[model samples]
Target: MTVLDPAMVPPRDARAAFRDGLVTPTAGWSAGWAQANLLALPKDRAYDFLLFAQRNPKACPVLDVTEPGEISASIFDGDLRTDLPAYRVYEHGEQVAEVGDVRDHWRDDLVCFLIGCSFTFEAALLDAGVPVRHLERKSNVPMYRTNRACRPAGTLSGPLVVSMRPVPPELVATAVRVTSRYPAVHGAPVHVGDPAALGVADLGRPDYGDPVEVRPGEIPVFWACGVTPQAAVAASRPPFAIGHAPGHMAITDVRDSAYAVP
Candidate 1:
């Protein structure tokens, strides 16, 4: 069994995971700072992917786009190719490799995207006095594929993916209010209440991440997740692609308060 040592985890400024030799999942690190889901595409497909994200804003909210061969993003001032703690490289739709850095794979024709993630909203939920079960358990949030379809853009389209959080019925309203303030990072819950309504059959089983107990008096709340893009990219099977390993998001210098819309 591999034990994760918090002390061994690299600091937020270390840049790429390869720099710090971190190849583990990213959860519970970089508590208050905003983290982003990563997507890298060949320059030929960059325009199409960008339009797709624009067409389906809920699932693919764009935070920043980096020029080909450039690893840093405008919003965060960090290198996309080296900043993430870990990366998943995909080729023609199938995941070909997982690495700590993409510097070796970097190409002048590749464009990088840094999209919003649910971690930002999770922080707001905690601040609002709403319970976040996964945080309490020190585990990744449960994620599922919903029957709901995202609006198609070019070759990018797929069923929406959602992250689940079991909140008390009384605090559901509070969760919405707090999360709604940050639209760049997944915003608010897309579905609240029953999981089956979204065609999710089993609460114990999730397509991604770990499942947690939904205690009495609590309801499962689901939000559109950054993983949705990963699923789309997987299905599209681009010749070459890269993304942050799930939960190992790219920490940005941009403050979360900047995203809070009045």
Candidate 2:
């Protein structure tokens, strides 16, 4: 088990680790703070990207958008280039490289978008007595690309992506209630059993993150993922793009409650 130091519990401490070139996954970092997925493309196509996210609200819930060339969000108060654990640079829709920092790839014409992540509901889940198996197992939550298609907008379209958790049967209802309060962060599970229904053939082999064990009495619950933007970037083949590597998210300074509803 990787025992994190007490100093690492703060959001600033986590960001410092990334600044110091840490390439590990961002899950479990700054637990109460919201974590976001990132997407960057050229300024000209920014409208298309915005329209796409608006059209596919489930997978691409908008959290924050940046003006062209800006690297920091008012909510996070940090430079995106150095704050994330890893960045995936895509060129012509193909992932060209995954780097610890994106300073070299940053361009004046690029616009960054921050999307709400399922991690926002994690603290609430645990508080409500729901187990986050990935945290217990010390692994990143599993993610899959479903056959379900997202509504297309100009220059962006792809299959829906989902993040999975193994929820105990008894806590299923509680889980839904706890997460549904955070609509910006994917709200609730879209599918809860039968992975094949989402075109996921094997839960053991996920498209992203680590596989977690589903207890005998547990059902696999799937939530719309922020990573779906990356899938759209892949399918659309934008001339230039950058995104947080799977499981490595932008740990924002905002509180989870900031996006939650009564």
Candidate 3:
């Protein structure tokens, strides 16, 4: 079996592949396009989750939102129930299913939110010569739940989640500079060096996604992750919800440059 080079595929084609049952982390997929985190909740809980996102912008930078029962967004025309590489179903905060399609569980009252993903900035990081270890290793970017708590919003609260990338010592500043230009996608490093400060006791064991080698002398830099919403779902335990599996993102039609700052 041959795997497509996601980095070289077009966003629409990438999504089509996903709909066709192709499963892979989207880090380098559709190189110049923005990717988004997926969160679908019932109409009754939408307002609370929206407020949670507003109160925690860094970890939940929303790119687009769908009307209740709508399966597509302006920036994401693909079918929300089947276009992503994978989906997670949660009930009362406990994850109950991880599947490639959600149409079986889709509800008419579900409202979908598309949050900006750091993968939107990885192309920029590579262009600037910063190493993205997960991409190099053909693995998922590691994510951790931090001791830091996000601001609570109307029945929702959880610890902030962060994605980790290892950069060479000399390129740390460059990585920060490039990523800062994309605030819509969790811009800049929220914490760099000493994972202990974030309460990450082990680098090889991540709360979400797979761990990649940090390499000698490379420092692990942390960025606010869109997965924070899923963490919120687990903590707040609303009656029900659906989200994309970590690292398995919805490759949006929007270009990454759309989120870049001057």
RMSD of each: 3.0, 1.7, 1.0
TM-score ranking, high to low: 3, 2, 1
lDDT of 3 by residue, 72-149 (tens): 999998899999999999999999999999999999999999999999999999999887889888889999999999
User: Per-candidate TM vs. native?
Assistant: 0.91, 0.97, 0.98
lDDT of each structure?
0.80, 0.90, 0.94
For 1-262, candidate 2 gives per-residue lDDT tens digits of: 9987522477788888898998877767787889999999899989998999999888889899999999898777888998999999999889999999999999998889999999878889999999999887767899999999999998889989999999999999999999889989999889989999999999999998899999897999999999999998899998999999998999988998999998
The regions of model 2 sitting more than 4 angstroms off are 1-8
Maximum-lDDT candidate: 3
Candidate with better TM-score, 2 vs 3: 3
Which of candidates 2 and 3 is the stronger one according to lDDT?
Answer: 3
Task: List runs of model 3 lying over 4 Å from the truth.
Answer: 1-3
